[model samples]
Target: MRCQPRYKGLVYIWLKNKQSCLLCNEPADGTAPICMACETELPWLGDHCETCALPLPAAGLTCGQCLKQPPRFETVIAPWTYGFPVDSLITRFKHSAKWPFGRLLAELLAQFLQHRFDEALERPDALVPVPLALKRLRQRGFNQAAMLARWLGASLDIPCEEQLLKRIHDTSAQQDLKAEARRKNLRNAFALAPDAPIKGRHLALVDDVLTTGATAQALARLLMEAGAARVDVYCLARTPKPGDAT
Candidate 1:
């Protein structure tokens, strides 16, 4: 599947593999690349709060909660809410054993960042993916967040420190906990590198999604305490409060 340039020389290719398309085949004539249908389904985020990245309610300012109490992480940039095609897209890539979408999702994030912060990209820095507990990694077979970080690092030409932050404690599913309870659940769950210092350096903390943000808060605290000059969160999605899943 591919979208010919609006005029010419654009040529979008392989929305996915041809095999996954209704037409069917492995390479599926990527001459254009992503098919027209797949192209339309590409999840994109429009003008949104630069802080939380949550869709603002028409005239509201800073989503109320954020204005009251900003998250510990400096900023969040997510291309889509944790729903629909974005949800299915992540599941396919993480659980269904498909790996290509990881890069696709990272590209979408990069596009969003470029649109919002073209000048910020020139700042050389490190990307540290939220680490997973050894127990969870053993159970799930992969850390989707880490994989997403790797993909983003490659596309953005930034370095992903990969193992700077450590999950000091194994936490239960934060999804089931209340926002306040989530803070307690994730308390002391993370730690900075023993001697590795990111002091006076900018760090982009990557994760698949932001939920109660308790885990993110915990990580931000650790990084700051470890002497990080600043920390910004970059998640793929944000799960709305109550009944939302990412």
Candidate 2:
């Protein structure tokens, strides 16, 4: 969450020069393999509302909505915003079935969590991916979030239990809905699996992106109600947007 900008700034400086004499082949401007010129521009969450990490009323910590009803997940760390290259990358992996990213993101997410939450992340006993319903899994071919969880857990040497939680309902895409609608759409969407158990465990919930955070909140409540001691959210990106309190 508080990282001193790294080689990226230097990379950007090289990119702005537009010289054919590039030093590294890293994707020009991104957190990738090309030089700075080729990297996709990423939006950083600066001066954001602390509650939901959304760009605020150009002011304070907690946004008005978070003050009214806070989300259930304890702490969140999303390294980047869900847009441009990151968005397209997620789509490529999530929709186009790029499976290798599963492992790559896992390590990256673990590193970010270590940075963002530090000791807090070290406390989670397990990493659980937000589950996908049966129908969606059949359609999408793979659960990208689940892949991330496994990879992250392996990187941290923590166990990953894929069956701990599940989506019992199939809901419409939250990307297409308003904030209130997204919350309503996700209500009762998740249910704990009968065979899976999580009593007395501190769980780190992993997801690719969090927008309204409705799904994570709902799942966090269910997990606590089922006996989880602590729950932290670890996402690749958190969408920032304007909102009416939901």
Candidate 3:
């Protein structure tokens, strides 16, 4: 006797797609160019420090660095760890101008943030992408943070202000610097726009990645000084502390 094939229904048919995963070239499960298995293996952040979002041994606890000297921002919210394909994706998006990667990252971040907002997280009144120095902007022809902020704001229905903050100093890159030097380098790097109406507003500062968070601290302090009620940091990924493995 021949057995009949089981009918899985229309939902399965609707989800079937011919798209391939961008990372592994496997059949993608959804609109994203990544498959479910690959997505599960991505560097998702877990058990992080509440104050700085640094990878911690457990959740809801502050890191020692944050406890000793708290950053200007109220909290850091990043969805991924800066590892594996996440770092590669960000580098390609930011430095190599791979916009599709950026779009995908932004979409994922937005989805994560939306869920957070639904689950008792307070939404910010506005988003401010960390500004690029004029010289650097001219050289790069675009700001990766701004691009992410625009996509997030559109998705989340928050106002995104690109001109609210200005990068006054074209300082050297922060990638190679120690924590102390990074803070010192960004001391006066950011300034608020003269006419930005940020007073009493809960603002979120958006960026592609949060490493040492020197840049976020500098910008948050500037925004607070300009009368913002609260400042939050939102980034795609957070790097682990130096000498610590993720």
Candidate number of the best lDDT:
3
Tens-place lDDT per residue, model 3, 81-194, is 999999999999898887878887897899899999999888999999999888888888899999999999988999998989888889888898998999999988888888
In the range 127-219, model 1's lDDT, one tens digit per residue, is: 889898889888888888888888777767788887888988999887778888898888888877778767887888898878767787788
C-alpha displacement of 43 in model 3, angstroms? 0.7
Please state the error at residue 98 of candidate 3 in Å.
0.5
Query: What's the CA RMSD for each of the models?
Result: 7.8, 9.4, 9.2
Residue-wise C-alpha lDDT for candidate 2, range 1-246, written one tens digit per residue: 968845443322322424221223333333323343433244544566665666654746777777898777777667677666667667777887755344444555666666755644446888889999899899988888888887777666778888988898899987899879998998888989895677878887888988888888899999999988888888887777744321
User: Which regions of candidate 1 deviate over 4 angstroms?
Assistant: 1-33, 119-124, 243-246
* Runs off by more than 4 Å, candidate 3: 1-18
2 versus 3: better lDDT goes to: 3
Model 3 residue 173 CA deviation in Å: 0.4
Which sections of candidate 2 miss by over 4 Å?
1-41, 57-60, 101-103, 117-122, 243-246
Alpha-carbon local distance difference test for all models: 0.70, 0.71, 0.89
- TM-score, cand. 1: 0.79
If the candidates were sorted by their lDDT against the true structure, best first, what order would they fall in? 3, 2, 1
TM-score of each: 0.79, 0.77, 0.91
- Give the per-residue Cα lDDT of candidate 2 at 243: 49
Native-to-model Cα distance after best TM-score fit, residue 101 in candidate 2, in Å: 4.4
Steric collisions counted per model: 13, 15, 0
